[model samples]
Target: MTRTFRGRVSRLTAAALLGTTLLLPSSAGAAAPFPYQDPALPVATRVADLMSRMTLDEKLGQMTQAERGSVTAADLTAYRLGSVLSGGGSAPNPNTATGWADMYDGFQRAALATPLGIPMIYGVDAVHGHNNVVGATIFPHNIGLGATRDPVLVEQIGRAVAEEVSGTGVDWDFAPCLCVARNDRWGRTYESFGETPDIASSLTTIVTGLQGPALGGPASVLATAKHYLGDGGTTGGDDQGDTQLSEAELRAIHLPPFQAAIQRGVGSVMVSYSSWNGVKLHGHQYLVTGLLKGELGFSGFVVSDWNGIDQIDGQSGFTAAEVSAAVNAGVDMVMVPTAWKNFLTLLRAEVGNGHIPLSRIDDANRRILTKKFELGLFERPLTDRAWTPTVGGAAHRALARQAVAKSQVLLKNAGGVLPLARDNNKIFVAGKNADDIGHQSGGWTVSWQGGSGNLTPGTTILQGIRAAAGPTTTVTYNQRGTGIDGTYRAAIAVVGETPYAEGQGDRTGSMSLDRDDLRTIATLRKAGVPVIVVLVSGRPLDIAAELPGWNALLAAWLPGTEGGGVADVLFGVVPPTGKTPMTWGTSVTQQPINTGDGKTPLFPQGFGLTY
Candidate 1:
């Protein structure tokens, strides 16, 4: 009889067991009445249960995301803030992976200590590897990856980046910028995959790589498909300017990538700061709700860009009206960085007044909590320190090297100057970018608008050249190309734009080679060595006049950290496979040149050379 009874009890369903267990005292000697605490329940059921128990304050808190510097751990608990983030360049005092983990754990601790014990999510702009943490592997920016035209490679890079991020306890990444960059003059052009929606749409494989097969798996992160609806087609190639394209053009040029990302089950969609047809995206109900959520079937929460709501009324600061509009428009999460307190106050007041409906509040909380539950935040909220060592690991760096090699576009290999013989040749390397790791990595490195000179650990182009050279080869370096002589078989002048991001990088004037770069090439030319120009830039430069003088030209579009990849193609270790992701304009005047566009470019889209 005892054996038969035990057998029957063992066969009970998990829900039945959990139901039976809830009747008894929990380990903490308290009643576990909430069904949300049970891991076996469906995410939607758990979200509903949790939302039912939450107060107005708690619901609003889940929708607020404050920057790390703006709020303390104690404040996180006091306000029941749902999320925290680190802006570019923002880091802990130690600025190590461990430090970041500790920081994240502290905030999470505060969040869990709240009445209901909901864990808070932390986000960062880990666009290129775990960029905020020093010593983290910095992969080449999106422009470089776009040039590769290899979705599989880009996806692998995303997985590696997710691993590093998970090691540091950051669960959310504002990455894989899906904008179809229409104009090279846009300062944020490098953030785009290519000029066409196809390139960006193809690269949506990164969404799978980031989140993995499922959300709760190890190395899984919440991938964001960002800058929704026509940020890339702005007039005058402006950063936050209006995109005056017709609805058809917007859907054709910018919507496909987002559709692909949605199909891949992207966890979040961030609204763009830019406007569409003289309307701010942050307050655009049609795009955010009617289009992205309704038509696209995107169940994931929509998040506002950093302080994006402030610009809805062309204002300097956000107001109650802005909050109402943004929330009503379906921005489930607000990145109120520094103004979170004010935002919360306004949001609460607005909700109380029925300006922002309680249904919308519940909807936002439901969406946010669903992700938190799916992330296994309740079961495992702290950092997965086991992944810590993967940061800057040899395997990841090797992968980065491969990506860099694949991204190298040989624009002009005149007289087969490239595939340079590794042995018995004197090589002279010169220019600002040749030996500078920071410059090679480009913006969104350790800091916001990444700085130059050994800011982080990585092989410089000169270092790679020397390492790849044979025993008999001698490689000499001079930043200004002053030491080159006629005896050298070839001179490599690696010069281009220094690090800048967003509006600061905008080029309204001439996009010609700088005076310093021209001078460096002139110095090398005077020595009678065949000048090989390795342009380390984010976008195509106007080099039509200077192209005639250089023997070979390589567009090394911001190859981060692993400069050996650049050297790989240079010395024929790897073949040049990268095609021009953007149209190489004949002059700066042909600003919006694209593949099907009427303007004839210096190097058409898909142009590249091999050994």
Candidate 2:
């Protein structure tokens, strides 16, 4: 029995007699039109109307962002959660593009089923391509991209990454870590574009690539400028350490990149876990609200780093006081992860006690809902499956290869030892990174810390060398450099750090090559063959003492997935054009060295050799 509203005729007269209204509200309530549901209303008008109708619980939910593992669909609907995120390595059982889409859709359905029908946004650390997904193209980390000095190429990579992310139903990317790294020993050095603010500023083109000219465009995703002010300038290069800089120094070194990001219309800013002097950024109202939102004219919402609120009082876990402080400080979205329920309870109590203002709560919801409206989530909130096939397509891989080639900085090529003949010769490839895709990709890969050896599908440098070799040439690989002999023309020792991220990767002591790498190079040196050292590292390693021993050297800064690009420069298919984005210090003691700092470096910034 179908009953029609408006001008349409109803087949079920009996149902009509029951006085049920269909499309429009009955004549009694006709004077009050639902402006929020009307597509013709301006976005601002719609947002206001929707806010006017939301309850306190719904508004609080809109301010919260829960991790997927801790929350279920039932939880989302019951609490009206506004967002969900898959932490690094958090994926569906299958972990395929379709599997992700299904998971996202299920959560989204639950979110929409709430009384207000607000769609929940999903975020992931897709910092370097759709990194969490298997079979997705992995581009070089920011340090490698910075070496390329190609903003246009970076924008293209951003667009490709956005497409892949959209295909999987994720709407937000916690990316473009705009921290201007001041020290190489920082575990997150690879996340930064370079040490200087100029590099990070110039690369803001990635913002436009991710968001397009406007929000809600096809394939557009929310972009986040992260670890706001002084995170990269921490004392002693410690992860989540304090930055003991004056206001002027902080503005000079770390603030410019975020200013550039704001100008690019980036949708969100992430608060840093690190502190300035002694004040934690999560609770710093002056910076989060007064500076970024007020002085910088940023209209976007601010998100807290993963469980960042817990560290406000240097505590192991978060307290009600911490929650109140963070919310009052203008963190619109709280990434509580596992403790989201506790966060909600604390926040509600705070608000009820007037420790947190209703005005602040409304402001947070307004900022978050505005972006959701701009994203057109109400109109189209599901995964755009059409883009799924582009995840690890050949074209993206080709672009990655090109980026890798451009990122290779040839530090030394003494006596023209490179461009090794491809035919009628034998090449020896040795060291841990020579044949491992994961080793070259570095951290923030499929998993948070990443792993070694064929962790994902990609071309290894050894495979590229063999593919580029002529029919008469042979390529042999021995990870430990044990099989090298005088018969080999040259020994390519690809050695460097394994995968690590954040606090786990911070090195407070020696920053030089490991003993195993030195031994491997020594083994190749014993063979009496020309030794070419390729360093696959996140930052500059202390290798000045070993420089004179190698015939040639290439700084391949975490060239992800496409190892063929490294081979291209090695075989002369492409000229070395990348420059060192960070100054290579002569020793570990010169930790904070930079260009124009008066101290001599092992290699200056922008220094690279040609073929």
Candidate 3:
């Protein structure tokens, strides 16, 4: 049974978890506990008392979130910053589970040393299973999970992710990307569950999984609904580009998922870097304040995207005007990343000159502090090593494998070529993705734009096939599909796009399989064996012209860290049930295709063939 992580641990446990505080203030423990530090007080009462004790500088610091690389423990003590975050691929030296916990403890100690002793919060883009960690269980991306159409399974993945994240002392996750991906050409198509609001909204179960029915549980990590408002419906699938939809279209297409997230008690909402109709979301008061906070009744803090405030003025860098606009628009915490100091200085001036109001600052602080108290961060500010071993545990990996298998969409199994015979058969597996773990995991793995060639620990698809094959069965693999003379019973060509994320992943040009993949499959075809083309991709590729030549096709959308799941379906151990999360394009010209758009797709949304 799952443990309820929101139960606040004792102060002794928190101190033990924190270990020796090298930077504990010289006057530590001399004063009595403040009203805000009392565990029995109401959250509102505590937040109010904490606000009373804080100075103007401390109040400003509570709203600033700095990137880990740009700030240190000493800086936290001096600036009294409220939060810190590890950008994608950012980690401390040693970059292991213990290293992360130690780094977090160091920072917590500094924050505790301050006059008010307001514990700071740490955040990460743990979108796909604590991805920054080298050996964490990397679950299938949102598109793959979306294919499963199982909200229960998504919630389970969320719980596992929260456990892994908590083990590393990260309390916040910028995940459950509820963007209703309307265009396959968008680089972030995989981040969305499906091309419709229903799919994304259903997966809000992940919020419950992360938060564990309520906040401040044994392994709870606050979940975030990201890139708020129309990031997925961008013009030309352009990342951080203009979204030309009207208010009605926007409310219908993109707003439902956020509503679901809020209902699930999601602790944070990330402002999108993209614009709606022309106005950037980071500075949109009517939407952020009036719609999200006022109408939606969202009490959680609104965080800015990575340097998202900087783009509000359509400029190269953030300015005083941008700071004022974002705050005035109801942004509680500014994620300025490297330029946090500048943000603090400018924001302080903005408040002094009446450009930004005091009520807004207090409201933002109240929202931010309430969640911190609700999360029991004030009581347990350090890593509980008990959860550390769960980071890449066997159980989590098994769950990831299950998710991968469920996510596999059997697009084509013509002539009954699937469910390859397990015994007395010879299989030839070829393609760049078949043997590469990094290629299958795709972007947002250990790095920002995920790379190929043994990036982390995980079984490759070819490895899974070999492991799943019967003792009598023989499996052979070649990267380029060479040396085949019809001796094999079947040729499995795992081919698709290489690893990419966000900006680089957009398909403004042709969305066809790369030259290497085409050549590899073509080579396999010449051998006269039944060809099985498994697509390891972030989004549906334009494979209409090539579909006729292949005997079988499986849309394996970037199954992360586990390849055995692919073999589970291939060898008849698991039935294929996944459907297309996004409309599969026949050609690159159908860039913004969706359900009811009237454009003929190669495989319409929800199209999947089972044996």
Candidate 4:
């Protein structure tokens, strides 16, 4: 059952008892604007003063974020919303770097139309490079980077992501996912570093890389420590189901990375879509308020997940009253990709009726404004053209190539059979993802849940292999993993899961070898030829049941767009040094084992046998 808090402003003894100056920051003494003043300035005072002048409508606007094309500048003025975001697929018409910058400027043009003229902050996922825009250099997914275990390399990657993203006028990045993925069955596991807090903490080198010591420093892109608490530890390994854990378990396992990120001065945080126990995280006051805000001392604004506020009341329970409850529960901004007007209406009524205290509203607004100020948005409201050429230049792609090479974990290379003959006259490349750029890029690419076929500009493994082998080698492509003649010197099978996002791909157990996959592997193995199995998947599966028959194994972990990079290492141009970011279970039954386990994983974490 859900409870709703509804009361009018006039009868609120909560505010009355506090004082008429409820919204005012606490005085350190008498002249002090706040008990804990912003070292950056009495900027809190400026924010407080700004809040005093805003109407209920404007304050509601500050708590809302809309997509780029979903609404226009007119909508911003009409609703007085504070922030704007571009989801995975959302982009300008042409979808070029300059085109995206112009598109962003156009949206801000509308958002600043209000009486107070506050500029809207733009945000994007950019999980693997500035992936939304075409021609942007797509990097290896987090799971791949986790294997590198080089904090300095990860930090450089973060800086590269920021430089590219900021080139398009975007300031906020919802990245450095702190979730220690305890289960690979979760679809978003590839987004996480590993199943240990220490690994996740180390990968959070991006926090320092994104937000520099001062602000506006190179590679600084307003980092967000996301999906607060245990987003990766849901019941039955579901994406947004109940995460059953004691408070102690939650803190020990999940809270440390966020604390570490906070110490690095991460500029923002995004709330999780899952519930902690029985209550939706969006509506949970204890964690978002008492734990993150009060105890952890997070001054950054907490943004909601995509349409996460609606989950508060459940699918059938969305109502005006419930919307107000979520807002008061410590959600500063709502990612209302649609139906934003309803949020504004509910928030205005709640504020006027006194269900939400004015002080709470001020607090939320101040947090949002503080990030904007720290980003130096007030001084430089627009992006310069100087960074445009650097967006996806040759140097960036070189870094991408290095990332791809380092992230490919060679699981098995029996008898040094790999480093296959690139000079061979006949080479059989069979799999759906081998030549397909979209499949190579995986989720959050050109489209939200990454489409099939070549959606972006990049060379596929087929292309890369051909390039490396010169004109003499004949490469045959098969999407269905069939038509293996075995007449060739060798065969390369690139097979894995298709693209998916969040709850859509969430699964538990039963990651077995399919009949089709088994057939493909068997055909190549029986051909009296060497088979190089490049397994590209988000989660480590039950490969132990089927691996003894293979000549070589490579865990590519969703290598994006540049399947050619995989080709470079496959043919002996570069040695494979990448290790297993997560432990591979021998079977489905031996799941959830960490590094400290006495028993061995099929391949333990940091296990890489280089030849």
lDDT of 3 by residue, 241-317 (tens): 99999899999999999999999999999999999999999999999999999999999999999999999988798
Weakest 10 consecutive residues, lDDT, candidate 3? 21-30
User: For model 3, which pairs clash?
Assistant: 5-217, 5-218, 5-219, 6-216, 6-217, 6-218, 7-217
Against the reference, the lDDT scores of all candidates come to: 0.89, 0.88, 0.89, 0.76
In model 1, the runs with Cα more than 4 Å from the true position are 1-32
Better of 1 and 3 by lDDT: 3
Q: Model 3 compared with the native: what TM-score?
A: 0.96
lDDT per residue (tens digit) for residues 453-548 in model 2:
887899998888888889999888999998888999999999999999999989899999999999999999999999999999999999999999
The residue ranges of model 4 lying beyond 4 angstroms of the native Cα positions read 1-42, 421-426, 470-487, 591-600
Better of 1 and 4 by TM-score: 1
Q: After superposition, how far is residue 513 of candidate 1 from its true place, in Å?
A: 1.2
Provide the lDDT at 68 for model 2.
Answer: 91
Task: Give the residue spans of candidate 2 off by over 4 A.
Answer: 1-33
TM-score versus the correct structure, for each prediction: 0.95, 0.94, 0.96, 0.89
lDDT of 4 by residue, 1-611 (tens): 00011100111221243233322222212242432222245566656666777887788788899887677878877787788898879888889999987877666656544555566788899888888989898888888888778788888888788778877878789897888887777888888888788888887888877665555565357888889879988876788878899999899989988988887888888989888887888888889898888999988889998888889877753566667767778989888887777777777778888888888888888899877756655434455445666677777777777788888888898889778767746777776667777777778887788878878777777788888785677877775546777687778888777787787777565777566667777777776777878887877878897788878888888888666678888877888888887888887777666677675788887887666
Q: Tens digit of lDDT per residue, candidate 1, span 1-611?
A: 12112111121222232233212112224444677876667888878888888988998999999999999999998999999999999999898988998888778777767778788999999998898899999998999999999999989999999889988889999977999999999988888989999999999999889988778776789999988978888998889899999899999999999999999999999999999989999999999999999999999999998899999999799999999999999999999999999999999999989999999998888889999888877656777777777888999999999999999999997788888899998999999999999999999999999999988888999999999999999999989987778999999999999998888988898888899999999999999989999999999999999999999999999888999999999999999999999999999989988999899999998999988
Error of 4 at 197 (Å): 0.9
